[model samples]
Target: MDRRAFLTAKKSKQPASVKPLPLEGRTSTGLAVYTGAWTKSEITHLLKRTMFGARIDDINYFAAKTMGEAVDELLNPVAALPNPPLKDYDGVTGAATPDNDVANGATWINSVNNDGTIQSRRRASFKKWWMGCLLQQDRSIREKMTLFWHNHFATETVDVSNANLLYKHANLLRTKALGNFKQLVRDITLDPAMLVYLNGRSNTATAPDENYARELQELFTLGKENNPNYTEADVKAAAKILTGWRVDTTVNTFPSYFTSSRHDATTKTFSSFYNNTTVTGRTGTTAGDLELDDLLNMIFAKNVEVSRFMAKKLYRFFVHYDIDAAADANVIEPLALILRTNNWDIKPALTTLFKSEHFFDVLNRGAMIKSPIDHAVALCREWEVVFPTAAAEYADTYGMWNYIMSVAANNQQSIGDPPNVAGWPAYYQVPQYYELWVNTDTLPKRNQFSDLMIGNGYTRNGKKIVIDAVAFTKKLSNPGDPNELINELFEILFQIPLSQQVKDQLKKDFLLTGQDSDYYWTNAWNIYIASPVTANYNVVNTRLRGLFKYCMNLAEYQLA
Candidate 1:
């Protein structure tokens, strides 16, 4: 359509927030497949929950496929594991431990460096690389799931001070992100960083440290709130079964090892919650693996509790925070059943939940408050903010990543280090689950981040990364018409739709220069499109920048 006819044609009213259908009403359809209209709203909801942020390209791409196909592709990742973090910190400080073995640009994950200062720098580099992964993530759910598992098995880089060990622990989480949950627990039990953080190395026959054992059931699997859960005696017995495992710090490869001398060769018995199961004592070389298998068998036997606990966590992360009795009975229970029926495989359960009618319900949409990382990364992607390419400008790219990581850390969701073993309280804490992410201090900082990006942005190594307002607006379907432009921007930037009155005020105040007629914006956009000169570009660009800035500051932008 030509610009004049497009503006003169009879246009449909702007879509309001999703409302209940006349027939189905607000009642949830539960885990059944969603057969509703697949528009931009539905696509945005799916990607917002599954990935970090929903890009326009991704939205258009997924719109052509069935919801089942999109969810399947997200669950099944084919991308290779990202290369390890490099040695990108040399000139920052002279007093830090000199990494003599690795070159300046080489990856430090393989070389074992025990120096405290150098290890600290490497940890920072790891954080930068992690931020890059989120920014450059594929269409799959690997990076998000990797972060979920990291929080599930929380560890602090400060506590586990070895950089190499931290890399290995994270690699383990990424590798088994969508794999078997039961086996992930098994692998994390023997991870060297975990052994250091939870005092697993100190757990021996003479002095049994119950730190890891208690957390294994209480936090990781069965959960502390379950009725008739494992007892204190169960914790002690589990610790005894796990006594012989120790970290071999000298070797860089496979640092965790089992020591026969440290093994407590006594029969360990559990409480009636475990059906009074007993792991028999063993001797010789394979005692540690044998007892561990027995322990996992005992814990996973109560598949109902294990599955329910994990199902709740996943629900909170990927769906809404408040899981009332209705959600529990209808959504969580069936999802847990799917998880257990699949023998603890994570893919099938997530696939069913993402494609469910309950998940795509109107009430479920825009219910979640974006976490710190979500707020930061989504702004970059949805605005098409640019960052230096890592392959071409390694230091400049990592420096930009470090700046991004620092912003998120200041807002209180550090990537490599969560606050505690229970992970971020926002995921599991009751009464105010995700609301913990936004307080007086963090909210201002959040707005400041958006303000900075849409305005000046951050600069590093002679490269300035900022959101180009004109570039973003040009990508819209109809930028010449002020109403259509607002509609397209609202469709991408917001989870919920703005009222028509508010959108009109926004257009008049910013786009139309406080005038009543639409031709003001239409003529200005046309002039810029025709001439392609600096003064003409400034006219449209200035208005677009103001419009975006005002929209981002709204409370609605913070919701997913």
Candidate 2:
């Protein structure tokens, strides 16, 4: 059934089932440091934006720290980068070559294989591995920032068509998730997957491909909306400067090399927007690298435009989508200044914005519809949904991750493959913005996904991975008290606070089983606690499952 029909039926029973964001735009709270209370509400808000989901343990762990300390810990990730994608599949049938070179569970990232079927399987492996990273992310903002950078510097694995190149590109994003933005742009310019995706490899002295150059200015930096922005001539000049770069597959490292012969040696000039700056082209090996640096310098010199554009994108990703005049003046403008003042080091700016009063403001919470990946990851992480271990259950582990990737792809936020070079429309599209995530088709699928995860979950290789609702409630302060259990669950699972009336109704409908007294649930839970025998266990487990499933299916759960 469609989302409209489903939500309508749901709302008929529970009036608070479908709460949409207010038509009025977002909070006017600026980048001033917030001195407000740092309760579960604020902690949940911070974690939801920074991490996949705010697990109970994560919220409580961060609760010990002051706001600055928590933000500091989040920005500074200490974990080692995850190991590369492995060869998870058996031989691909009806193929030109076999993938038997790499062992069943060994990493295929460094191995060189040009076989189409093998590359295809490796691509699947790459996506599954990426999902695993998101699932197993540490208590830091690294994963979320990595994803933000991925969307910002989008390169499609499908278009690149090389699994090794895709893995390298992904590694670049992860390695520099919070590194210098200007350096990242430079790195991405020479990245092999980017060269393949944006036709940078084909850009030569005789013929220039304006694809990457145009995107470099329009989408990446000096955003298209800015008045007197980089001209078409500037794009052509940048493309000329970027010529001669080609992926060097002959070398073991598979890096992109500068081909001196293919480079344009003529001087390239920019428009008035860049103060008529000219990048003097040079000859020999250093020409491509030097000219490219000059081009970036010229663009980044427009620091206001570049920083503000970046701030807006970051704001949309971490905060609300809409950027009103007040938000632009109070938040985006100053945030841009912070970015520029920090010399494009992303961590400080992120640190400030995340700790600001505006971030903690009530209106800022529950302002965005969670992206498909966000929703899926949050569901698994928050619920502590179990997956098979990669060490022993290699196939099953990857199989489960692959299932999640497929579900996300179907929901329109495919990790390795966004719809286009512009990335997902939901991030940058106007009027609708994040609202694009929910629609007739995708919303029901979202609900169905949570329902499945909360219920039977997805079974892989004879192992069923689902939420252990009984065990999860056992972690609560008082599972015996129906009201406290509901309150605790709401605090963890929801961004917006539910009314006491709604909580009372939920208790009656699910835990209390329509009984007037709360002991109906309290006694059932205590009985199960005393004797976890099949009969008593079934009584509590059934109620808890129903409670969680119904809660997850609510419209509030859809918001991050």
Candidate 3:
């Protein structure tokens, strides 16, 4: 626990290279593995993509089940992991009463800018809550999809400053992350946080603002890349169709409201791009909901691009960024058809893709680089690091949130604070795509974080949280076997193809200490297991930490 223990720990003597395994079905678990023949590596790959990182017990449990069963378990999120409540109460008064005017909007602007206030502290707590969820949330892959949707329907806390609204907005995404796509669009369109973020709050029939409408088609539904399906006319029509909705910033909750007075009572028509669709606007209290439904029906039912666009975006997010000619025909195009046929439900496409033969392609294992959240969370999960937890029971969770957010920001993927409406460039952007996550600027910071977590451990407010290397390595099915530890840790830590020679060298140099005898490691491990207070456990722990730190610094470790 002492910092001196870290500085005195043994260090890796030499760096080793572990090449990525090619896309070939050599071993039973290698590339071309069918649904039934699930390999350890294949299971690891599934967890890495779905669970952010795989827990040892999860890997062992799912590895025994058929691929179908595994996929089914992932699709059905566990009901046990409830959303952490916003238990945030700032001693400040709620905003003034709503007058069907922009008073609430002005009040929000002031609160979003304050630094030394409970509002700001509450927002930070809100983000920390989600990050803690990432650490401890059930491994049903729901959180992964929630994160995907977060980026897809991106909103930052800086703009939507209210923690209650932010909490509502996020829970909306989690509840229906795998649900129907149209419902999410409608819900987000009227969400108070979203309305404010995209200037939907300012939109009125008299002077319609096209901010939300443009993004609805451009960024959310039909992507702007090479698509000409929606025009500026459609955005204006949508804006007119979406008017009269206002956020009542009065009272404790600034809920959205429909104002019939400001509503555009006339019929709004779309251009030929949308198949000449028409949303006949109404003036009643339900006008906003009715017209918004009409607009979604027009986009989803009338035009087919929405399904394909959403499918493609999800494919890129979950799988490889580069969909070549072959993959376009084989993967993306077919996946789009699945999306359309399934009525835009996310589960079908995800089920088909994760279980498909192409997903298990060995070369695809380390194809995408891990985002900052993914990288940090993976290390924590794999190392079995006991977090101070969301409650900060034993550690400074507030400080942990700031630390994680700072690392993500430095790495260009700030969690609750995306740069703009487009979310993190790692999810989108060209050529580089995920490669942008690690460049000259972010790579060192990521490496430094791993070093700190493993070396000195992370400390906040004088409380230390370190990965118990001895405890973790002992969790292995066979800790005494040097060769087993080497290979197994590779499966747990990195997804790349680890060479046998490299594995042997790692065992010899680190675990075996150049001894050819397997009993050397076995005996040392036995002594540690019997009396861990002895020098034997200390040696084992030091070697394991040194090797882990070395692996974390390797280039292969950067990729999922």
- State which candidate, 2 or 3, has the greater TM-score: 2
Model 1, C-alpha of 549: deviation from truth (Å): 0.8
User: Could you tell me which 10 consecutive residues in candidate 3 have the lowest summed lDDT?
Assistant: 24-33
lDDT by residue (1-560, candidate 1, tens digit) is 01222122222222233222223222334676777878888898989888888888898899999888989998998989888888888724653556777887888887766677788888889889998889888898998999899999999999998878888999999889999999999999999999999999999999999999999999999998788889999999999999988887566684899998998989999999999998999988899999999999999999999999999999889888777666776678889999999999999899888987778876677778888888888888888888977565888888988888888899989988899999999998888888899889999999899889888889986798899999988887889999999998898888776889999999999999899999999999999999989999999988999999999999888888
Which 10 consecutive positions of candidate 2 have the poorest summed lDDT? 5-14
Which tens-of-lDDT digit does each residue in 157-220 have in candidate 3? Answer: 9788776578778888888988988778888999988988998888988899999999998888
Per-residue alpha-carbon lDDT of model 2 for 305-340, expressed as tens digits?
999999999998998887877778778888899899
Decoy 2 TM-score against native: 0.95
Clashes of 3: 0
TM-score leaderboard ranking:
2, 1, 3
Candidate 2 local Cα displacement, residue 543, angstroms: 0.8
Candidate 1 stretches greater than 4 Å from native: 1-27, 91-97, 390-392
Residue 362 lDDT (model 3): 58
